[model samples]
Target: MESAETNTVSQDPKKQASYNTVETMEEVNDSPVEEVRLTVAITDDPTLPCLTFRTWVLGVISCAALAFLNQFFVYRQNALSVSSVSAQILVLPLGKLMAATLPTKAITIPGTKWSFTMNPGPFNLKEHCLITIFANAGVTGVYAVNIITIVKAFYHRRIDPVAAMLLTHSTQLLGYGWAGIFRKFLVDSPYMWWPANLVQVSLFRALHEVEVRPKGGLTRLQFFTAVSVSSFCYYIIPNYLFPSITALSFVCWIWKDSVTAQQIGGGIRGLGLGSIALDWSTIAAFVGSPLATPGFAILNMLVGFILIVYVVVPIAYWNNFYNAKRFPIVSSHVFDATGAPYNTSLILTGKSFEFNREGYDSYSKVNLSIFFVLIYGLSFAVLASTVSHVALFHGRTIWQQTKASFNDKFGDVHTRLMRKNYEAVPQWWFHGLLMVVLAVSMLACEGFGRQLQLPYWGVALAMALAFVFTLPVGVIAATTNQPAGLNVISEMIIGYMYPGKPLANVVFKTYGTISMSQAITFLSDFKLGHYMKIPPKSMFLVQLVGTVITSLVSFGTAWWLLTSIDYICDQSRLPPGSPWTCPGDDVFYSASIIWGVVGPLRMFGKLGLYPGMNYFFLFGLAAPLPVWYFARKYPDRKWISCINVPIILSGTMGMPVAKAVNSVSWFTVGIIFNWVVYRRFKAWWARHNYILSAGLDVGVAFMGTLCYFALQYYNIAGPSWWGLNIDDHCPLAKCPTAPGIQVGQCPVH
Candidate 1:
C-alpha cells in the first residue's frame, strides 16, 4: 500500500493556480496517470463561477431537448444515441452568447442574503462542463422506459404513466446514491481513472484552447464545424431521397433469385459478406460508433464475431442443433416446431397475465433461434469472463487502491487541490436520497393502479444486488471503459426468485441493472468533474437536477410517441422503411418472455429444451484462465494478454437488433480511424478524431430530427423509385431457407 504521508502533496491554492506552468507541474509530486498529466490541466481557477443563470437556462434547454430527441430517435431503425459530446460542442457558443446578452447586475433575494448574476464573469470552462453534465443526464438512455414500451407495444398490456414515472425515478436515483457512496473508491482513487472520460477531458481542453491556431493546421472547432455540416448534408440522400443506399448489398444484386446468395450476403437476415451502409446512423446505430473504441478493443470484438457468426453458428445451424434448420439462420423472434411466430397471447391467460401450461404444450414449447440463444449464453459468459479477467489482471491494483482510498494524504494533485478548495458532498446526502427513493419505489410497486406485482422485499433485494456489483463492474468500466452489464444476470435472478410475473421480472431487472449502470455513469461524470475541477457540490446538484429533468422529459416524449404514432412498433402494420421497428425493445420483450413469463424453470432448467447452454457460465468462468496463465509465463509477449475474452464473446452478441451490416461497418470505421489513421496521422488524428466523431453525431441528430417533424410526420414519403423504395433488395434474405416453410414474399426453397 502507498505510504500516505510520503505521497502527500502540498494543497497550497497559490501553487495550484500556476499548475499550467512547467515549474508548478514539476512539483506535482503525487501525479496521476500519463494521460491525465498530459491532457487534463492541473490548474484551478477557484474564482471562476459555476451554476450561473446562463448555466441554468442553457443546461435545462439542452437537457429537455436532448431527452426528447434521443427518445424520439430510439424507436427508429438505427437507434440514434446522441451522446453529451454533441451538447458539449453545441453549448459552447450558446453559453458565450448568453453571457454576452444576459444582464450582468447582481440580484439579491428579499428574504435571504443569497445573490447571483445572470452573467457570472466570462463563460469559463467550469460553466461549459456543467452544461455538459446536464447533457450527460439527458443522454443516458432511460432503460426502465423499455419496460413500459415492451409491455405496451410488444406485450399489449396497460402500464400507468405514473407508475412508469415512479419506476424510472427510483432506478435513476438509486445510482445517485451509489455514486455518492463509492466516490472514494471509484472517483478519488487515481487507479480507478475512468478511461472514457479522458476523451471528454481532451475535448473540453481543446474547446477551451486559448491559442487560435496551433502550428497553423485547422483548429479542432473549425474541423468539427466543417464535418458537422458535411455529415448533415450527406445523411439526407440515404435517410430520405435514396434509402436503399443505406444498405448497398451488391451480392444481393448479383444473385437476386438465389436464397443461398441473399442469406449469405444480406445485411439484416444474413452474414453481410459484402454489405455496406452509407448512412452514419446505420453504421453507428446499434452498438454505438465503432470510432469510440480503440483498434485493439475493436479487434477483440471482431474475433468474437468471426467465431460466433462464421464458425459456431454455421456448424450448429447446418447440423440442425436445437432444431435450428426450421428457422432463419439469424433471427431474434421466438418460434415453435413449425417455425411460426410463437403467439404469446395464445398461452397467456388474459387479465391476470399468467402462463397456461396446457396451451404451451398444445401449441409447441418455446424455442429460440440458435443465434439469440447463443447470445444469452455468451452474455452469461461475459459476466463470468469479466470477473475472471479483472481479478487476474487488475486485482492487485484494485486492492491497493481500496487500501489507499481511506487516506487523503495518498490523493493525487487533482484530488488534493479539490479537497482543499471545495467542500466535499456529505455521504448522508446520498444515503438520504437512497432511503427516500427506496421508500417511493416500494410504494409504486405495491400501490400503482396496474398490478406491477413486484413485492416490497423485491425492491430491497434488487437494490442490494446492484449495491454489491457496483465496485467490480465500476472497476472494469473505470479502467477498460467497456461496461460488462448486469442486465442478463439481474433478469436471471429475478426470474428464478419470482417466476411467472413479467412485470415484476422487468421491474427487478431495471432496478438491479440500471441502478448499477447509472451509478457507474454518474461516477464516470464525477471523475470527469474531478478532472475538470468542477466543485463537488455543484456537480452533485447539476447531476441530480439534470437527471430529474431528463427523466420527466423523456417520459413525456415516449408517452407522446406511443400515443400519436399510427401502428407504432408494429412492423407488420407499418409501411416499409417506416423507421419505427423498436429493435432494442424487441430484445427486451423477448427477455421478458424467456425469463419473466416463461421463467427459467421451463426455459433453461430440466424442463427446458436446451439445458446444455447453461455450461456457458462455466465456459466463461474458465475461458480467461488460460489467457491469464500464459500472460504470466510469457510476460514479454503482450498480444496474448490483449485477447479480451469478454469482448470477443460479446462481438456478435447483438445479432437480431444489430444486424451484420452494423457490425461490419462499425468494425471497418474503427479500423480505418483507430488503427490505420491513428498510426499514419498520429498528430492530426489526436487533434481532430474525437472531435470529428462528436461532429458527426451532432449533424446526424440535427438532420434526423428535422426529417421526422418536417416530412415523415406529414406522410411526405420521398420519391418511391427503386433506390428510395427498396432496401438492400435481397428479397429472400429475411426468409427461412428450409423446404416447405411458407413466409410472406419468400419463394419455397
Candidate 2:
C-alpha cells in the first residue's frame, strides 16, 4: 500500500517533504470530490435515524443467515490454518455477502478507491456483547470453577450480574483514562505494533478489497451460501443428534490428543510422573507469561518439565512426606489444619460435591503458600518499576505530549502527525475519582452478591486500600503485561482485613482488584488504537459495550457450561485440568492466607513486610536498575530496557510448546491449501481468498453453536451416551466408595 510516486529532490529540507505539495489549480479542478470534511473525516452522520420496522426485521434475518453461512464455509476450508490468509478467509466472504445482499453507500478507504459499503447489519456492540454474555452463561451454568462453584452452589450463592458488569466496566473506563495519557508512545509510534490488532486490520483490509472489487462478487455469493447451509446443518444436527461441536475447541482437542501427547488422568494414577508434573496453575503461568510465545518453547519445555515434576511436586510433599514420612494421598478421616474434614463425607457424595465445596482444600498448603509468595513478590516488583519509570522518565513528557495531542485532534490538523502536547489529568483528581468509583461499586457489589458477605465498612476499606496499592502496580501492568497486579498480595490483605470471610475475599479479588487493574490495561490498549487512527469516541463506546457484554456473557456461559458438564459429566471431551474444572482460585486462596497473616506482621515488627529471603524484593530493586543504567549509558543503542527483562526471559523461554504445535499444524494445512488453490485453478487466489476465510469462521462459529447444543445440551443419553465413565474422571470423594476398601485408607503403591 505504499505510494508509488517519489518526491523530487529539493534544496530545502522543508520543501522536499513528500505529500506536502499542494495540488495544482488544474489538478484540483479535475478532481471532483463529492463529499469532504474540512478538518476531520466523517463517515455518514452519527445521528442517522434508526431503520423502519420492516427494514430492521429484514436486517436481523439477513445478519443471522449471514452469520450461519460465514461459520460453515469458513471451517470447511481448513479451519485449523493459522496463517493471515486463514483469518482473512473468515473475514472477507462475510463482508462480500453483506455487500451483495444489503444496501450500501460509497466510502473512501486509505490508499484505495471510494468503496461500496454493506450494511453492518443489525449487529452493534450491544448485540455482540449480549450474544457473548449468553454464551458465557451457558458455559458457566454447566461448569463452575469447581471449588468456587461448589462453594457458591452449595451456599445458594447468587452474584449480582449488574454489579459484576459495573465493576468490570468501571475498571475498563479507568484503563481508558490512563491510556489516554500515554497515547503518544503506545499509539502514535509506528514501532509499537500491537500484534493482536494485526488480525483485525488485515481482516478489514482483505474484506474491504473484495467488497469493492467487481470480480469478487460471485465468490462472495458462494461463501454466503456455504456458510448459511453449514450453519443450519450444524445447528440442526447438534441440537437433534450430536451437540459437542465448538470449532475452536475441536481443533484444540485434535491438537491435544491426536497431535500432542499432553494428558491429565483421573484418580490417584498420575500420567506417569509427567502427569504429576503439570497442573492448571502452571499451565496458566506458562501460557500467559512470555514463556509461551514464539522462540521460547524449548526453554519453557525444559523449565516446565523440570519445575513441575522435580521442584513443585517434591516441594509439595516436603512437609507431609519428606518431613513426616507421609505419602501424597490424604485420608477421608483426616482433618486439615482448619478443623474441617480434609476429605469429608460432605465431598464423597457426587450430589454434594457438585453443589457444596467452599474455598480451596485441594492443594497442599505449601504449594498454596508458594503461590502466595510469588504473586506478592511480583506485585512489589511491579510497583517499583511503575514508580521508577514514571517519576524518573515519563512525568514531564506525558503532560507535554497530552496537550499537543489535544490541540492536534481539535485545534490544528498540522499537529496531527506530531506528538500530542497536552497536560495529563491532575493526579489528585484522577485518583480521587477512581476512589469514588470504587466506593460506589464496592457497596453495590456487596448489596447484590450476598455471597460476598462483606461488612460494608470492611468492603470499602479493602477496595480503597487495593486501589491505592494497585495504582503503581496497575501502571506497570498497563505498560507491560508482566505486572504484579497485587493479586496474591492483595488477596492476603483482604483476607486479614475481612478475617474468615473467604467469599468476601473472592469478590474483592475478582471485582475490586481486577476491575481497577483492567481499567488501566484497557485504556492503554485504546491509546495504542488511537495512534493507529481509530476514532477515540467510538473506541470508548465499543470497549464499554464489549466489556459489559463479555462480563455477563462470559460469566453466564461459565455457569451454563458448568451445569452442562454436571448433566453430562462423562461424555465431555474436556480435560481434567480444563479451566471449567480447575480454575485459578488456588492462587487466590494461597495469596489471601499467606499475606493476610504475614504481611501485616512485617508492619508492626522490626522486620519489613515480606522480610526474609525476599527474592521478589531483590528482583524488584535489581530488575530495573540494570535496564535503567544500560539505557542511560547507551542512549544511541535504540530501545533496550523498555522490554521488561523477566517478561522477555519468560517469553523467550516459553514459546515453543504452547505455540509451536498449533503454528506448525496451521502452517502445514495452509501450505497445502495455498498450493491446491493456486495450482488447481488458473484463477488468482489473492482476490477470493479473504472472502473465503471469512466464510469459514462464520461457518465454524455456526457449527460451534450446533455443537454446543448437541454435545452439551440435548444429548439423549447425557454422560452415558458414549459409555464414558464419570467415575474414572471425577474426584475421589465423588466416586463411589471402593469395594473392599475402607473409606479413609490411603492407596497402596
Candidate 3:
C-alpha cells in the first residue's frame, strides 16, 4: 500500500519527511479482516507535520461552524445528523491552498531556541483526518445541553450558565476518560475495525491519493464528484418540491379507505410494509448508510425488526394487549386511558415539578402503544444480549489483547508501526483525568441549588452502569458499526430508584449514556488515527481541543436561541412553516415527563398498567445463549457466529424518532449493496461503495442546508399541493381497532 515516493529527511520546509522502514510491500493491504484490506490503505509518512498553522485555523473554523449549524438545525423537524463528511470534502482545497500560498518562514519562540514554520511541508492526509476529527467533535451536538434545553424551554426552570458548562464538559470529558482507558482494547487491536470509519478512510484517500485514469472507467475522485453533484440535484424534489416521495407507501394508495390496511402499510406510523424511500436522507438519516454496514449485521437487524414489528407487535395490538386498542398501533406519543394526548401539566406538582400522587390518582393512567412498549422491552434485551454476545465471541481476544498491550506486543503491523514510530498515551493520564471528571460531575449534580435533583449516589450508579456496559457495547460497535444505547436502561433504573424528578432522570441519562457514547466515538477516532498513522499525542490533543470548543459553541448557540426568540419551541403560538418548533427537544421533553415527572413506577411498576415489559430484561439475558450454543455446536459453519442477537434485538432501534420507513429503507439499501453488489461486482464495490455513500450523505446535506437557508428560513414553503408536504396519505393508520372508540378524524371502530 506504499505510494511511489522516496523516504528521506525533509530539510526543505515545504515537503513532508519520512524514515526508512522494513515492510512487506504487498500489492494488497495486510490485514486479518477482508474489509480493512479492501478499504483502508496501510501507509504512513511519520514525519508529515500534522499540527500546522492551517490546522488550528481551519480546525477551529470547521468546529465552530459544525457546532453552530448542528445546534441550529437540531430543533427543526426531521433533523438529520450533519456529519463530518461535509467538512472532510470541503476542507481539502482550503488546507492545500493555505499550504501553497503561506510564506515558508520559521517563527522563533521569544526566549527559547524552539522554532516552527507556517507552511511545514504539503497538506497531507494526516492533517485532513485531524480536521475531520474536530468536525466530528462539533457534529455531535452536546448531549447535556438537552438537559439544559428541557429544563429552560420545556420545564421553564432557571439553570446557571456555569452549571450548564459543567454538565457539558463533565459528560463529554468523562467519555474521553473512558477512551483513554480503553484505547488498548478498542484502538490498539486490529480486530476492532470500526465500520463507520471506512467511509472516511475511503473518502480521504479518494481525495488525496494520486491516481491515473484507467482505460475506460472513472477514477475514485471522478466518481465521487459526479455522484455528489447528481445526488445534490436529485434531493430537491424530495426535500422541498415533493416531500411525499420520501416515504412511498403504495399500499396506502391502493386501499386508502381501509384502516387495517393503512395500519399495516403506513411507512411513518405503522409496519411500513412494501414501502420505499427515494430520498437518501429518508434512508440514511436515521441508521446511516447501509453500504457502510456489514451484510451480516444488517441481516441480524432485519431478523429483530421482523420478529418485533411484523410478529410480536401485530399480535399484541390486535389482541388488545395492555389495552393497545385504545391508541394508535405505533406512535412516539403517550396517551391517556381514553386515548387523548397525555399532558404533563395535568399531572404535575406546579413549581416543584414533582409527581403529585393526589393529582395522578384522580387522572387516568399513562398508556403506550404496543410497539412503543416492545421497543423498551427489546432495549433491555439488547443490553443483556450485548454482554453475553461479547463474552461468548470476543472475550478471549480481549483478554489476550489486554495482556499483550501491557508489554506493547501487538501482533498486527499497524500497531507495530505506531509503536516504533510514535509514543503511546500513558495509562496514568487516563486514570488521572477520569478521577477529575468524576469529581466535577458529582459537583455539577450536587451543587447549583440542587436544581439538577440527581443525588451523588445517582451519579455513582450511572457511572457504574456505563462502566459495565462500555466494553461489550464498544466491541459490538467496533465490529457492527452499531451499539445498543444506555439511554432507556439508565432512565429505567433512575426512574425506579428515584421517581417523580424529571430534571434528575434526564441528567442521569445524559451522564450515563452520553459518556459511553462519547468514549466509543473517541475510540473510533483513535482507530482512524491508527489507520492514517497520525501521532497518538497529536490525536489526543486535537480531540481535547475540539471537544472544548464544540461544547462552548453548541451550548452558546442553544442558550442564545432560547433567550432571544419569542415562542421558539411553542408550536401553537408560532406561525405556520416555522422551523423553530423544537421537534427533537419535544421528544426529549416527553421522555422527561414519562421517566421523570410521571416516573416508571406509575407506568411500568406493580401499580402501573404494564409490568410485563420488565420480563424482557430476563428474556434479553437469555436471547444470546441459543445463538452462542449453536455457533459452538457447529464449528465449521462461519455464519452462525455472525447471528448477533444484540443487533437483532435492537433492530427497530430508530422507531418513533426515525419512523418505520427509515429502518425499512436502510435494510433494503444495505442488502442490495453489501450483500448483492458486493458478491457480484467485487471490483466496483471495493472502489466506489463507500465513496457513493459519502457523496450521497454530503449531497443531501448540502442541498438540504441550501434549501433551508435560501428558502425555508424566510417562511417560503413549496407550492401548496398534495406533493408539497409530508403527507404519507395514510390518515386511517392513526385509528384504533377496538369497537366504539372515537378519536380525532379516524373512523369509529
Candidate 4:
C-alpha cells in the first residue's frame, strides 16, 4: 500500500555507505532510506585559510591575464573567447609550485586574530578554488563592453570614462544580489548539478586525490600533459602559419565560381556544409567542447542547426525575403537597401543626434540578411519557450525544494552536509550589496541621460525586468548548462519605449541582459563551490572582490586597446588580412539600429516589412505546451522529455559570428566522445573525457595568447604564401550571386 518513493527508499540497501565511496548519485538513490548519504563528504575545517597571500597574488595575476585575453579575442574576425577552465588548469601547476617554494613563515597582521602564511599549508584545495573563482569572474568577458565598443567604434560617439566604468561595475555586481537570493533553490539542491561544474569537480579530484599508479593506462595528469603539449603545438599551424586550414571547404576548391559551392563550402561566408576545420578554436568556438556537452542535447541542437542553416536560410534568401539577394547571405554588417554600408552618422541630426527623417529617407531603409532575420525570430521563440519548458518539467520539484529550503529541513544529503558544515553567507550582506548597487545604478543612469540620452526610468525598468527573469533563467542554466539570454527581450522592450534613441536602447539592454547573465554565472560558481564543499562565506567574498577586479581590468584593457591601436576596429584603416574586424561589435551596432533607431513598431508592425516575424513570440509561447503534455503522458519515453526547444534554438544565436563548420565539427567530436566512446568504453571515457577537454582548452588559449603578443602585435608577417594566409583563397565565396546581383565581385568561369 506504500507509495512508490517510500517503497523504493525502504528497499534500497547501499544507501548507508559513506559518501566518499559513492561513485555516482544513481548509486545513492538505489540505497536504503536509513543509509542515505551524499556522494561527497562534508567537513568544517577552520584551519584551512582560503584568503591567504598566495591566493590573492595568484588570483589577481590570473584575472588580469584572462581579462586581457578575453577583450583581445572579442575584436577578432573569427572571435574565440577563452574559458575560465584554462585558468582552472593552468593554476594547478602554479599553485603547487608556489606551495613548494613560497616561504612558510607566517606574517602577523597589525589587527588581532589575522595572521597569514605565504605557503598556506600545501596550497590547499580551498585556496585553489578561490583563485579559480577569481579568474572566472574576469574570464567570463564583461558584457557591458559591447555597449562601449558599439558607441566608440561604430557610432563614433564618445562616453565619459568614469561613467563607463561605473556602468560596467554596476551591471556586473547587480547580478550577485539575485544569485545570493536564489542560492536555496539553485545551489542547495543536488539535482541542480550545473553540468559544466562536473568537469571542474572531476579535474579537482584527479589533481588532489592520491592514487596508486595503474598499469596499462595513463594517469589523469599524464593524459592531461600529453594532450596539452600536442594541442599547443598543433595550434601554431591553424592559428598562424596556415590559418586557411581552419576552414577548408573542398567543394569551393572544386568549383571556383559556383554559387552553390560558395554557399555550401565557404566557412566564413556560407553554411559551411562540406567544410572541415582542423583548428580546435574553430571547432569549439560556437558550440563549446564536445566532451562536456551531453549527447542528447547535442542531437537536439544539431537538428535545429541543420534545419535553419541548411534549409530555412537558403530558401528565404533565394526567394528574396526582404530583398535578401541585394546583400551577402551571412554577414554581421548592417547595410542600406541599395547594398551600401549603413551610415547612421549621416542620418542623425547634427545638433541633437536624433534620427533625421530627411537624411533617413535619402540614406534609404536598412536591410538585414535572411539569416539575420531568422536569428531575431528564433531568439523570441527561445525566450518564451524556455520559461514554459522549465515550468512544465521542473515546476513541482522547484516548489518542493522551495518549501524545504524555507523550513530548513534538508532532504538531500548534499544540502544536509552543506548546512551542517558551512556558515551560510548572511542574507543581510547580499541585501546590503544589492541596495548599494541599485543606488549607484541610478547615478549611472543620470550620467547616461546626459551622455547617452537614456532616461532614468528606463534604467529602473531594466533592473526590474532583470530581477523578474533571473530566477527562471537561473533554473534553466543550472539544470541544462544553457542559460536563456535576456538580450532579445530587453532590446525589444527598451527599443520600443525609447524609439529613435540608439544609445539609450543599448544602455537599457546592457543593464538588463548583463545583470541576468551575471547572476546565472555567479550562481553556477556557487554550485561549483558547493560541489567542492567550499565555505559559503569565502565564496561570497571571492565573488564580490573578483567582480570588482574584473570590471577595472577588463574596461582598462578595452580602453587601452581602443586608444593604442590605430584604426583597430576600422577595416579600411588596418592592413588587409588583419584579424581585428570587430565582428561582434558590428552585430551589436546593427541590433542597435534594427531595434532602436527603426523600432519594432516600424519593422515588425501590422504594416511593417517583416510583420510575420512578430508572431514568433506567440509561437514560442505555444510550442512547448504540446511537448510538455506528451512528456507527461509518456514519461517512460526518456527521449521525449529530452527535447529542449530553447537549447535547440540556441544553435542559431551564434550565426552572426559563427559559420556552419563550427557546429558540424562540434557535433562530429561530440558524437565520437559522448555517444561512441561513452557507450563503448565507459570507464575510459569517464576517467579522461573532461581532462582531455580541459587540456585542449588550456593549450590553445596559452599558445594563442603567446602568439598574439609575440608576433601579431608587432606586425611581423608569417610567410605570406597562399598556403599560409588563406584569407583570400576563395574571395568569390563572399560574393552575392543571385539573379541580377552585381554587388560583390564574383569570378568569371
Please list the C-alpha lDDT of all candidates, in the order they appear: 0.80, 0.35, 0.85, 0.76
TM-scores for all candidates?
0.93, 0.52, 0.96, 0.92
lDDT of 2 by residue, 441-469 (tens): 56555666353455566555545545554
Judging by lDDT against the true structure, name the best candidate: 3
Clashes of each: 0, 86, 0, 4
For candidate 3, give the lDDT of residue 369: 81
Backbone clashes in model 4, listed as residue pairs: 12-32, 15-31, 15-35, 16-35
lDDT of 1 by residue, 533-636 (tens): 89999999999999999889888888888888888899889986688888788878888888888888788888888788789999998998999999999989
Candidate 1 runs further than 4 Å off:
1-23, 26-38, 212-216, 409-412, 575-577
Candidate 1 pairs with clashing backbones: none
Model 4 earns a TM-score of 0.92
Residue 463 error for model 4, in Å?
Answer: 1.1
> What is the TM-score ranking, best to worst?
3, 1, 4, 2
TM-score of 2: 0.52
Model 3: per-residue lDDT, tens digit, 1-749?
22322122232344332344534363234568787877766556576788878788889899989999899888777675678999998899898898889989999999999998888867777888899998999997799988888888876779999989899988988887778778888888888899989898888888887677788888889999999999999999998999999988999999999998999999987789988889899898768889999999999999888888899999999888998988999887778888888876778887787888888888878888888888888887888878888988888899898888778777566777788789888878778888999999989989988888899999988888888788999999999998889999899899999998998999999989998998988899999999878898888888889998999998899999989887878876888766687766877888887788888887778888878888988888888889889989998999998898889888998887778888889999999999999899878888899999999988888998899889887878888899887857888988887788888888887
Which sections of candidate 2 miss by over 4 Å? Answer: 1-151, 154-193, 210-442, 445-451, 455-484, 524-532, 555-615, 634-643, 646-749
User: In model 1, what is the error at residue 480, expressed in angstroms?
Assistant: 2.5
In terms of lDDT, which candidate is stronger, 1 or 4? 1
Say which prediction, candidate 2 or candidate 4, comes out ahead on TM-score.
Answer: 4
